[model samples]
Target chain A: GLAAPAIAQENPKISWRLTSSFPKSLDTIYGGAEDIAKHLEAATDGNFTIQPFAAGEIVPGLQAVDAVTANTVEMAHTCSYYFWGKDPTYAIGTAIPFGLNGRLQNSWFYQGNGNTLMNEFYATQGIYGLPAGNTGAQMGGWFRKEINTVDDLKGLKMRIAGMAGKIVEKLGVIPQQIAGGDIYPALEKGAIDAAEFVGPYDDQKLGFEKVAKYYYYPGWWEGGPVVHAFINLEKWNSLPKHYQAALTDACAFANTNMMARYDMKNPQALKQLVANGAELRPFSQEILEACYAAALSVYEEISASNATFKKIYDDQLAFKKDAYLWMQLSEYTFDTFMMIQQRAGKL
Target chain B: GLAAPAIAQENPKISWRLTSSFPKSLDTIYGGAEDIAKHLEAATDGNFTIQPFAAGEIVPGLQAVDAVTANTVEMAHTCSYYFWGKDPTYAIGTAIPFGLNGRLQNSWFYQGNGNTLMNEFYATQGIYGLPAGNTGAQMGGWFRKEINTVDDLKGLKMRIAGMAGKIVEKLGVIPQQIAGGDIYPALEKGAIDAAEFVGPYDDQKLGFEKVAKYYYYPGWWEGGPVVHAFINLEKWNSLPKHYQAALTDACAFANTNMMARYDMKNPQALKQLVANGAELRPFSQEILEACYAAALSVYEEISASNATFKKIYDDQLAFKKDAYLWMQLSEYTFDTFMMIQQRAGKL
Candidate 1:
């Protein structure tokens, strides 16, 4: 009884495969990929479905971007920094040591030159990236012993790899790359002295508290790490304009959702870890200052060699310098006031 | 040549109208409504379109929700607290004095029980609410003179209303209810000693810096205040499943986009405000403490009378208590360190 519109009548049915860099067990990060798939299906009435495969199902977690680039998969959900060894510019896509926090990173990407600059680098690599998720500010990993000074970080073999590894190495830290599943055992068996994963919710799942007593605050290295949705450039170009818009909106939704879930879940997970005798510790000023200096040096070294990294990093630093000024004035003051009330049991 | 699917073939063409409570000049907040319309139109290939009307175009700013309820429009982009006079529960849907920040509020809504609890209250008012925008933490306000202590607040005439008015009234301040367009003239003419607006980005547009030299921060009452996409419950229920999903995702995208734009824009605006002889000031600890105590007393009084307000507020406070604990440990420490570097000009 109705005449079908040209757009609807010509709508093409398509299905694609997505590989996630995380296992289904860590639902917060991996679930972001699933959310994109779910929203696309519901928005298009199951016309555009994406089947998700966990790490190792199609390729190893660290190899997700490689799969996307090779066209082995149409898309990948991963953290860009995992392939930093190939190019330091990859690290800026996710995070950098002493880089922008989650909110600031999102601001830089969407409002500043982040999307354009980062995508320029990605396009060269035959990929297109969209920020799909974030893990707020992570912790400084679980330590078998308290890290009191710069001396404590010396010779500490930690499970950290990436731009953070390079920065820490300057502070006498021996960085080790360990798989997600192997972190707990490595810490327990003394094969590794400490490990840093995502925040409390995911870290608790990894059983880090069972082996390490001192849980540190402020993972200065990772800060606000972004997880990205990477799509093959050729495949991305072939998508209809409507599908592109739908996926963009869906990824943005997932980006916000992942952070919300972490914020909601981290509190309880942290409380549980504390009850299990996980000693919470703040990295002392001596250590923080030293690492901050070291981080700057590492940035200088990379910027000298990599022009692409330098361009994006320079833009991020400029934005960050001003962002923190405004942040410290408003949200900082408000939060500090509320925190005092909470400590006083007045809230 | 193609067999049309049942869903695609039955997709009905729809056009809806949205009224915003913000003026066209305040693009950050008002633009959020425009983004939703833009995304919806592009995603649905013009099958679904939403026309947005600025404040006073279709109805008065404060009457947006009413217009939606009366079916004058299908939806509205407005703050819930504007209708707090109708029911105190409305305030919780947007923000409250000393409540959750934007990130925490989003966490509560999407991951915690916020959406269900808030919608329950909205449903009672014949409305359905979705978080459409956030203006991170806001500046406290612009003041003609510095407020260095609680005593300085006594007998002060300020343009504030609703819950904050009640709390500040307990501190011997006379709260004035002035319209947006009237605020500039009031501050300039010494008719009001102080006024508060969104933040630096939107506040600069109001030209408060020219008259009120002392700008204070941590707008405690509106910390992370939310702007909602409110729909008539009857109209909302009639939407097709796919349309509902599209709207929901579209709103989330706008929510993130609005905050990103504000975060990116506020820094430059703040610098300009400072360059214009705007003296930045902080509310002293003594003043914050007194206000905190007065705010609690106000909440208690309202809780004694308003069950709906108490139900939603109690849940929020519980979430806020845990949220700050984790937030202070992670982002707080990180931001504090960065602020120190910025102050030292090391950045």
Candidate 2:
């Protein structure tokens, strides 16, 4: 409900410049940013136009935050967690290993106090954050071999993103942060033993199935990964009320679009991946348990060190516990039955 | 892909009866079923194991086509349009007239599609269709709503549904058809106003949202309407899968769960809708003209056909096409622009 005066009447035409963290090669994720530009112009009757720049065009993909904060650019669309290097607390805004799924995240944002908490986090960075898109529960990552036990993780060099890398590091594995475009080459040349991109559709598009034979599940790192639109705080405050509303509404629309595209596209992609000899494997209980423990330890460490991280983490963890309890009783039971029946050939 | 064989796993020591068009809601749409039942059972784990019944359970809502085709059953969860009737098709679906708003229909179906489609329709014969759920989009009953200059509709009574009864029939007006439970009522009601049901969502839900809504674009007939699950397709194919997939999937999941559940839960529902809605509602003055002409001609007929109906006809028709197209293009362009901006926004 933050309303500002109209920048100009008669549907003034204004062009904006935007920077993205993804490459054009990854259409869906990259396409999300592209879509926003398209819709904004159309919505404004071509009165407002925006020009998009891919990663590295304006700055390194990972350095988008620095650019936006420094006002090198007016806006940016990227994951908030990528900058956890600066502040571990930033990871919670994008995702946390084994954290809330997309639906729950939305609830946390729109219904729960997530947006307010996240906006506060962004204020410190001199930017305004809006969840523009989300990739609902991601696949663990592409692995060259099956992860049958916790021992397999030892010494494994993996290209992973966000806080999950911290958890994996606890298992004695080396976690490398690589940009999306660079992951394939890194995994292909043995620079990394594994890499986690997204679900089947995106993973397949990235051609990971070609190089990685054992695809693992239960993406312990990113349950629901949210992409954010980082607008310069000063610029954001300068927008007219309707324009802001328009931007907000458009972001919400884009967020929903990205998830749906994935859902509809992933099923077919998974089918194709299996047909192509991409083996889907579940992480063994040992590895799962080890990761869980490591994640907890990391959480404890962050909480003890960063007060801001602890504040959000504490509330998030509590909410997660309650949500899980509710889900276990209802969602789990029904899903278990259906999955059983599906496996049984009864469905 | 992970097709594990069913082991003779011990079943949980609990039993409960859960009804649905689907066996068990698994993902989003069905997820609700799973969530609701699972929560209920988990809240009482050992004390309760809900037995799920799919469509055709105890009855075939479809054959409310035949049984109500023959005089059967009790209780059914279905869309009204499924029984386009002993008369015109209008009685079977909801939308028609400017059609009830989605939020409003939720009110009407949980309250209206039940009474009008079931009570009024079924009371005449011996059957009932309850509005256990709704999917939303309804095609303008394959518009034969030839509205040219608005004066054309002199004696037409197309098969329209819900509140549309008041608007369309004003020109001339003749409404008919019974519930999916009693579609025979008004078709048995008389010539009738044009009717309409859902698109793929409920068309598949009732198997007609598609067929009837086929005039396609501008589903002007139904911007988005709800669907009901009719019962008595000879006691719903004698229980089992009948009530399992169809009822559970359709009513419990698809119908009730597809739209809003998707709108609320799925991150991309609206985006997909806009993308798809655009493909569906292309701007065409001619097509719009034809539909307007048909609508008007039919209206005139109804107005002349019945004096009581003609009283309210003028204002209703006046509002029918008034801002429909302007809004469509304006909103479409704005939305399209925003989508573009979003994509580029991240760049």
lDDT per residue, candidate 1, A175-273, as tens digits?
999999999889999998988888899998888888998999899987789999999999999988878888888899999999999999899999999
lDDT of 1 by residue, B86-169 (tens): 998899988898999888989999988899999999998899999999999989899999999888999999999888898999
Q: List the residue pairs that clash in candidate 1.
A: none
Which candidate number maximizes DockQ?
1
- Which residues of candidate 2, in runs, are more than 4 Å off? A1-11, A329-347, B1-347
- Predictions' DockQ, in order: 0.72, 0.02
lDDT (0-100) at residue A123 of candidate 2?
A: 94
TM-score of chain A of each: 0.97, 0.92
Model 2 - which docking category?
incorrect
Please list the residue runs of candidate 1 whose C-alpha ends up more than 4 Å from where it truly belongs after superposition: A1-9, B1-9
The best candidate in terms of TM-score: 1
